[model samples]
Target: MNPLTVLRDSLYFFQRNLSQIVTLCLPLVIVEAILQRIVDDAVGPDASAGFGLIVGLLVYPLYTAALILFLDARSRGESPRNRELLAQAVNLWPRFALLSAISTLLIVLGLSMFFIPGIFLTVVLAFSEYRLVLRGEAPLAAMKSSFNLSRGHFWRIFVCILAVLGPLMLLKEFSYSLFSKDDNTLLSLVLDSANSFLQLFVSVVLFRLFMLISDKSDQ
Candidate 1:
């Protein structure tokens, strides 16, 4: 699919299952909020807090993959129990966690050299969780698969992600500009909350895209 069409379909899918999506993501949202607060308190306005926050943000993708796996199974007319889904997800956690750590390290290392490589790594690994969840691949294999899947489609996927993510980011910036206090902490919190919600939404959309891409590839 073209970028715009992918975005349109993703948004439509999200809206169609909004209630179920929200219900699945609520726990992750709460956990993200708490982690944000903790990271903020621990780092206290330092630049390193951004890195810590990014590390914490990895949790959402893992949870999102689990949710998408469960939802997709149901969508395909499979009778998947929530507990069974959660167990399967948890079983994969160690591998996922290791891959996430490696990915984060690579991104950070690349960014330390310059920023471009970091962005490249981010795009390449974008489909790792989806690959792992959907195809039952090992973490490194999934990462490699995601990289290959995204190779020729880099710009397309990048544009699609930005289309969904850019507006939410702009809104957060505007809110902070309008309502930021002298202290900045409250504004930071508000922006973080907005970002968390947007990330959750994007995760769901991306999962749908992964499914679509996989189907097309199969055909």
Candidate 2:
């Protein structure tokens, strides 16, 4: 549960497997960007926030599940084929999507209550994806397990998530801050796509944390 050790390993694995990570996630990110653009055109400038959120949710689970599986495979010294990994992800999609949608709504609701609650929920339920994808648990069951598993490991998970996502958020803000609202929509999507792709590193970091928690619990 050492945050520094987890961050160090996350960066090490992320750098060492950068190419493979790109191979697993980049195409999906591109497709998500394309779909978002198409939706933007169809819905026009006044689209509801919910519509955009749903659109992102639809594509998000695919790559996320694949990346999680990729990280797990890599941990076991298995070089899984991209197609094979995606096929399994597809099989897991129904549960993953449901879990994601539920998590997103709850987090949004939490955020609405106050920003701190949202961050709290995010840290508390961080392990649901691992439970659902790795253990094949039902979505609700995974959520329950995630909530339970995260207990006593709160600060460690928080730091692991923050170390990766905090900088990512700042980078996106700083990068986009240089641009204007009048900037080309394509430029906006490109910036977002880069940010989305980089966030997959957060998945790798969590996988490391999941491994640490599992090892500790076993001992």
Candidate 3:
């Protein structure tokens, strides 16, 4: 699994299906950002950061599951409507939410332990969402499976993630420097939504890698 090939293909897919993806996920992403902003405003600057995570948990699973299902459908050459995909995602919400929460907690915990472990955890747990959503595994089981699945392919996955996210992180910093959220709430919201939406491309690349690894593992 060459990281460049994975990135190139994922970029192509992202560009090709940009319209459908925006229709399917952008509203939810904007909603999440708006809710987060509301929470921030209510709690003031001293607000607990975890409040944002709580808001995310409420809506993240919905759109993320829908996006994943859409990715699967497109890969299989089936054209699924957004509403239908959303309904299926809603049905899968409970499991997906649980999985996401667990993953986030573990990643956060790892980050607290000097940061390197966090990066390691992120890489190894990359495919847990795919395992859970695509194969119906329980949250913990999916995480464990991802750990095993990512064994030899860790560098490829890690490099691919960094390649995609590195520039985005810089863009985020640059945006913040130009417009303080407190002073320009609307612009902040727009930037936040756009950044979050672009991050979905990481999911696309990871899905590609997941299929490749799964195929090899099965064979």
| Top candidate by lDDT | 3
Off by over 4 Å in 2: none
TM-score, cand. 2:
0.95
Each candidate's TM vs. the true structure?
A: 0.82, 0.95, 0.98
Cα lDDT, all candidates:
0.71, 0.88, 0.93
lDDT of 3 at 200: 94
Instruction: Identify the runs in model 3 with alpha carbons over 4 angstroms from their true place.
Output: none
lDDT of 1: 0.71
Which pairs of residues collide in model 2? none
lDDT of 1 at 216: 76
Could you give candidate 3's per-residue lDDT for residues 117-168 as a string of tens digits? 9999999999998988889988899999999999999899999999989999
**Which scores better on TM-score, 1 or 2?**
2
lDDT of 2 at 190: 81
lDDT of 1 by residue, 103-124 (tens): 8788888888778898788778
Clashing residue pairs in all predictions, respectively, total 0, 0, 0
RMSD of 2: 1.3
